[model samples]
Target chain A: MELKDYNSCVQEWADPLFRFAYKCSGNEEDARDVVQNSFEVLWQKRQEVYADKAKAFLFQVAYRQSVDLFRKKGRIQYTEQPEFSGSSNPGNPDLKRVLERALSQLDEQSRALVLLKDYEGYHYDEIAQITNLSETQVKVYLHRARKTLKNYLVSVENIL
Target chain B: MVTLENYEEYIISYVDGALNAAELQELEAFIAHHPELRSEMSAYENTRLMPDTSMIYANKEALLKQAPKRTISLGNWRSYGVAAGIIALIGTAILLWQHTNNNHVATIVNVTINKNTAQAPVGPIAHENPIKKDKAIQQPVIAAVNHRKQARPGIASAPGINRLTVNDHQNNTAQPSQEKPEVNKPVEIARITALPEPKTIDTISPAKVLTAVITPNETMVADKQDEKDPFAWLPIDDTKKQGLKDLKKTVDKTVKEVRSVTNNLKETALVFKFGKKEITLNF
Candidate 1:
């Protein structure tokens, strides 16, 4: 990809990648950094990247950068905003809070697989490509992530 | 019968729709056999937490606005490199021109002034010193190095110093500085022949122009006198410039009686008669 086309790719995929990154890391600032840095990596290796596979390649870079950021910041706890407090359903804040906390409980790889699957609707193979895992690993890890979420939410329900 | 060991796999595959029809019926029968496992199935089924697309897309539009739109190309760089190369080549060409202009030595004349045409041929004067009788005898050799324009037929230019302008013998008395010609190249030696006595003005043959050979040792003695002032044309440091000025002042005070042989000399001509022919030459 040329630099011109890479900028276009940024315009094209920046949001979706940001959306995924924001979901993976619950911080908007970190998400933006991850997206910006991913685009930067794509720019550096633009010669090797094809325009067709640019979206997948960008998401992968964002994933690794997000994971690195997660490690660098230690075990990141999601800080929920006041705007995320009010919801259409009366009980949604609790469920969403429980879900966010539960998602943070998973390891970085498992959280990445789950976010790639649920937020992006990627297939096991696509999630595997993004996370550098085999399809079986993606499936198994995503299933484990779902189990953790369910257990956390269930315990929250039991307390309520 | 779904056992506890693989129950999680059966439940996950069932939720993922990876179970075949018989395995699905069996898992359904097993879940129906267990009631507490039903809510666990519901929790897993509804565990997907999606990012709000509207809020993220709004953020995306703002981020995209901040990103730069265009990039530099390889073609642009090639043009830049080519432009720099042309500028460098032009710079080198200018420096070479300046060096060539400043580095060359000024041309000096090696004429021997003859006071009397009877003792010397009136054809050309080669050196300024009257004391050097040997140089007066080898006047033809100095004529060759300086190649002064001879008034009559016998004088000719030297062979090697071809790219020089020879001063006429009449004007040789004007500038002593011009007489000490400064050639940039190292001073070299050459064999020269003396002019022969003319048998007849009409029979002054070209073969007889170079008649007698002179020794190189005689010219070396004259060249030692010439090396003093040849450095006048070059740029010098302050110390050397001061030294040259001091030397000039000292020479002006001490060398009053030693007049330049080329200076204050009147133009003298020698007339030769060969039977019916007459040759009047200036010295």
Candidate 2:
């Protein structure tokens, strides 16, 4: 792709890619690094990637980088839970925080599949392409991740 | 397709929006029949995460790529040609300047030597010698004075020998001499004894003739003679000396510049042609 197309991709996809990386990695710094490295890889291979495919290429690179980081660091547990100053009621508890805690419960690959699938609204084949998995595997993995999240939300003790 | 056995898959697919319209309606019917499972479907639907729009890449500008700059590569023959031409032009100019400077210095040295020689006292004195040419050549007055000084030392100290005389017989024999005389004669004798003296010539000691041959006046005249001066070949003017120093400095600077240029050129490949052979130099 040309420089202009690459720049346009940066402007258009940077936020979404960063959000995807953040959700996958669960750390702001790691997510930022993944996003930067993804663009850098995109620039190096700009000639081979068309303008329309740049977003997928960027996400693919980000996915790989985030996975590599996760592998290198092993499993990271979310220890610093945000404090809720008001009611301790499970039904009235903050859903965003509950969902973030739920996302943190899944493994790195499963979490990435869910993020790519839900956040970016990628199809099964597209998630498979980015994650280097078959469509059936993506579907099976994504369903398992969704079930895990659903189970976490269903448990009142876990939510409280 | 929407039975209780496969209902979980249907709910998951429904939450994922993977269900067709007819399949979605069938799942809705199944969910209506089993209304208690609708909460599970709601929980599954809540599992799909919405992206936090507030989270942005703060440094998006860093990823931009600028247009590449044009650079002149020495791989081109035209660049090499330009560099070689510049070096050749500088070399030629320096050679021509040095050639002209050397010629100028040579001309100045020649003129100064000729001018000093022309102003010398030797020419007029030699032509005006009154002693018979054959006798003067045979006696060789310098030798005669040396011989007389060795034979009779007392004559060199005589009052008559020191006295200035215009027509003294000793004066004429000593007048034309260019070498320093053996005896210590007064400067007046050299100045007065202009005509060649023939009277009392046999009575005079050779030391007096030797003493009269060279005087303080002639010593100064001899110092001006270019042939006798050791450093006469050097330029005499201070400005000319400074010019030579400046030329030397220019040559040194030019050499350093050429060396630097060649050093820079070493980064590129160079080709040389000799007869039918081609030699390529790469660094």
Candidate 3:
């Protein structure tokens, strides 16, 4: 990887990687920090890494950083949303808000799997590469997460 | 019956596009038969969530501002290192050539001195060592030395043999024995060097020179066959004569080998080309 290519890598991946880090870490500062760390590592290992592998490599690094930052904060397990809203007199319900809440409920790995599959349209294999999980695990975890989201919607619909 | 519990994995695979063509057709056929499972598929499809891209990333510029700088590859350094190594090699070769500019000579002479007190028929002491004025000097034997510290070959640790050396130039040199010799000295000196073989023993050019002999014996006895008195100067008794024959055969072989190896320096000569009148000086 040349210096020019390094700059190109930053230009190409900065936004999507930041988005991934932002979604994983749930904090803008931590996400920025993760993105910075990933690029710094990419800089250090420029010779070994090829241009094609840069995106996967960057995401892999970001995933690890996000996991570490989460673990360091002692937030390994996610604070799941309630299965159904207990509040009576249900008014206007936002599906996007419900989806965000559902996403926030999942643990880091599952959340990353869902984000990679849904938002980025990554294949099971691509998600596996990013999250350091097997393709089967990515598929299974993604399905389980979607089921949970459906369950959230179900609970919200039941309340309605 | 395709129940929801038995094939929920298949349902998920269908929604995620992970199902192969056969599996996808099988699922479609199964759902076609059971329309309720089609609703199950719709439930799965509706729950396929995508995050809001606009809201997810809040600070892109801050991350962009801290981008990476490039590193120089190991390949770049290797070329420079190789170039420096070649230059160093060339420099060392030039320095070595400059250091060793003078003449290169390898000479070895082996002389056997007889312990004869009988002061062999005295004549003009042309090559006599002034240091050993008392000793009888018969013939001047040129025993050259090498500057390089290589041990001279074919040397015997003979007791009671006196050793004297004088670098009086030319072949007028001799190995003088002890002051008072109780027995007759049997001096058998054989020298092999880049110096051309002398034409005859009679015309030895008796110069005012002196030296002792050590050893690299390859005496061309056949080359100097014209010498009427080759072995006459160093008289050998019956025992010494037998030893000389054996020694001469060994010296002949060694001389042939040395000549083959030291082919570079062939008899250092001064060629004087005075307008077609060429005069060669063999040293």
**DockQ, each predicted model:** 0.30, 0.58, 0.29
A88-160: candidate 1 lDDT, tens digit per residue = 7665445666787888889888888877776767778887887888988888887888788888888888777
Candidate 1 TM-score, C-alpha based = 0.45
**Which prediction has more favorable DockQ, 1 or 3?**
1
Query: What TM-score does candidate 2 get on C-alpha atoms?
Result: 0.52
Which parts of model 3 have CA positions greater than 4 angstroms off?
A74-92, B1-3, B55-283
Pairs that collide in candidate 1 are B108-B181, B108-B182, B109-B181, B111-B126, B111-B127, B112-B126, B112-B127, B113-B127, B144-B158
After superposing candidate 1 on the true structure, give the runs of residues whose Cα lies further than 4 Å from its correct spot: A2-8, A83-94, B1-7, B14-36, B57-283
Question: How are the candidates ranked when ordered by TM-score, highest leading?
Answer: 2, 3, 1
lDDT values, one for every candidate: 0.56, 0.62, 0.56
lDDT tens readout by residue for model 2, B1-283: 8887899999988877788999999999999999999888888888978888988999899978787887867576676677666765675566445433432111010000111222222222332233322122111111112222232334334423322223243454445443434123322222121213333232223222212222324322332331232333576532233223323333443455456445655665655554575656564
Model 1, chain B: what is the TM-score? 0.24
Reference contacts preserved by each model: 0.46, 0.84, 0.39
**How would you order the candidates by lDDT, starting with the best?**
2, 1, 3
- RMSD for each model, in Å, please? 19.8, 19.3, 17.2
Residue-level lDDT for B244 in candidate 3: 44
Greater-lDDT candidate between 2 and 3? 2
